[model samples]
Target: MTDENQRVDASHTPLATPGPPGAAPAAPGRARRLAAPVLTLAVAASALGYVAAVDPYEPGHYPVCPLFRLTGILCPGCGGLRSAHAFAHGDLITALGANALAVIGYFVFAGFMIVWLIRAYRGGPTPRLALAPLYWWGIGAVALIFAVVRNLPFGSALAP
Candidate 1:
C-alpha cells in the first residue's frame, strides 16, 4: 500500500495484545446475556414488594409530599405510590381512582420493560426509549397542567 493509504488505527489492538496492566478481563457472554433481565426483574420485584407491604395509605410509613403539605396543591407524584400499591394488588379501579396518570404511566413502563426483556433474552438489540427535547418539555407541561387541574374544584375527581 502507498504510504498515504497505509493508515494506522490507534484504537485497534491485535489479539494477544493485553489491555493496560491490571485491567480486568471482560465478563463472559453468558453473564452479559443474563444481566439485563435479572437486574430488571430484581428492581421491579423489590419496588412492588415494598409498595405492597408498607402501605402508602398508612400516614406514617411514607413521607408526605412537601409541596402538597405546604401549598395545599396536588403534585404529579402525590398519589403515585398509592397507585402502585393498588395496581400491585390487582385493584384496577382503586389504582385509577388514586392517580389515573400514574396508573397509565405504570402500564407504559411495563410495556417498555416487556419489550426490553424480550430483546435481552433473544440477544436482539434493545429498543431505545429516548424522546426528543420537545417531547420531554411537552410531558412536563402536561404534568404541570394535571397538577393545577387536580387542585381546582371542578377537577377534584383528579385529586388523590
Candidate 2:
C-alpha cells in the first residue's frame, strides 16, 4: 500500500513507551497552573503590614517629593501612599479624599485583577485586551480632564 493510503490493522494496538528506569512518579495536574490572585493577596497583605509598621504619615520617614515640595505641582503618583494607607485601613472616604484619581485607579486595578485570577484558575483562555482607537483616545481625554480638574481652583478638593 502507498504510504498515504496505509492504515494500521484493527487488531493491532500501539505500545506505550517506557519511562526512564528510576524516574520518580509525576504528580497529577503537575501542568495545572497556580492561581495568581492568591499570590497577589499575600503580597498586598505584606505590603500593608509594612506600611502599617512604617507609617509614611510619620514625619522624616519617607523623603518628600521634589516636584511637590519645590513647584507645588501634584504629580500623578502624589498621595498614592496615603490613599493606599487609607484603603488598607478600610476607610474609603479617607482614601478618596487623599487622591480621588488613585482610588479610581485602585478600583480598576482590583476589578481587572479579580477577573484575571478567575479566568486563570478556571483553565479558561487567558484574557486579551484589544483597545479600539476610540478607547485609547477616551483614556487620554479622561487623564487630561483629571489633570486639569485637579489643578483648577474649583476642583482643588480632588488634588492630593
Candidate 3:
C-alpha cells in the first residue's frame, strides 16, 4: 500500500493510539491487551484467597484424596490443597512440609506468570510455555522417585 493510504488506514484502525511526547508510540489495542493477564491474575488470586480462607487440615471441609483413601498410598497431589493453604497463610515451612513438589510447582508457575504478565503489558508475544519431552520425562522420573520413596517405610518424611 502507498504511504498515504497506510497513514489513513492506521489512523482509522481501532488499535492505534496517540504517540507519547517525542517518543515512539505503543502498539494498538492496549486496552484489549490487558484482559488475558488480568483475568489470569484474578483467577489465581481468587483460588489462593479461597484456599487461604478454607482450612484444608480440617477434616470434612475438603474431600479426602480418593487415591489415598482407596490405596493408603500418598499420591503426588495428596497434600496440594494443604500446601496451598499454608503458602497462602505465609507459612513457607509448613507449605514445604505439606508438599515440597507442589511448592516447587507453585514457584515455577508464579515465575512463568510474572514473565507472561510483563510480556503481555509490553505488547510482546507471550512466551512459549512448553517443556521439552526430555524435561517432561525428567520431571516424571523425579515424581516417580518421590512417590516410591515416600511410600517406602524409610521415607515417611516425604509423606504428608
Candidate 4:
C-alpha cells in the first residue's frame, strides 16, 4: 500500500484503546462531572451567606428597588432581597410575608439545584428547564399578577 493509504488507515484508528468486549463505555471523571454543580452551589451559598450576614432591613446597605421608588408600586421583585435575607436567616414566615413569590422562587431554585447536582454526580447530562413558550408566558403572567396583587389594598399582607 502507498504511504497515503497507510496514513489514511492510521487516521481512522480509535484515539483510545477499546475496552473489554460488552463493557459499558467509560464515564467522565467524578470531579470533572461534579465541577459545575459544585461551583454553582458555592456561588449560591456565598451569596446567601452574604445576605444572611448583612441586614437588608437596615437602610443604606442595599439599593432600593428602582421600580418601587419611581412609581411607588410594588414590583414582583421589590422585596426579593428582603425575602432572601429572611430566608437565609431561617425566618420562613417573614420571608413569605416579605415576598411570597420570591420565597416560592427560592424553593424552585433549590429543587432545580438538587436535581442538577444529582444528575451531575451520576455523570448524566446537565439538567435543563426547557420550558415551552406557553409556560414562559404563564410564568410572566404569574409575575404580573403577583405584582398587581401585592400593590392592591387587599394584598397589603403581601407587601414588604
Best by lDDT: 4
- Per-residue lDDT tens digits of candidate 2, residues 11-62? 7743543566456644334134444556776787788777657767888877
Q: In the order shown, what is each candidate's alpha-carbon RMSD?
A: 5.6, 7.1, 5.7, 3.2
lDDT of 4 by residue, 32-143 (tens): 8889889998999999999989989899999998888898999999888899999998999999999999999999999999999898888788999999999999999999
Pairs that collide, model 3: 15-28
Q: Compute the lDDT of residue 83 as modeled in candidate 4.
A: 92
lDDT of each: 0.84, 0.74, 0.85, 0.90
Model 3 regions lying over 4 Å from their true place = 1-28
- Cα error, candidate 3, residue 97 (Å): 0.4
Rank order (by lDDT, best first): 4, 3, 1, 2
Off by over 4 Å in 1: 1-31
Give the winner by lDDT: 1 or 4. 4
Candidate with top TM-score is 4
Please give the distance, in angstroms, between residue 95's alpha carbon in candidate 1 and its true position after superposition: 0.7
Ten-residue stretch with the least lDDT total in model 4: 1-10
Model 1 TM-score, 2 decimals: 0.80
**C-alpha TM-score for every candidate:** 0.80, 0.69, 0.80, 0.86
Model 3: residue 30 alpha-carbon error in angstroms: 2.5
lDDT for residue 47 in candidate 2, whole number 0-100:
81
Error of 4 at 142 (Å): 0.3
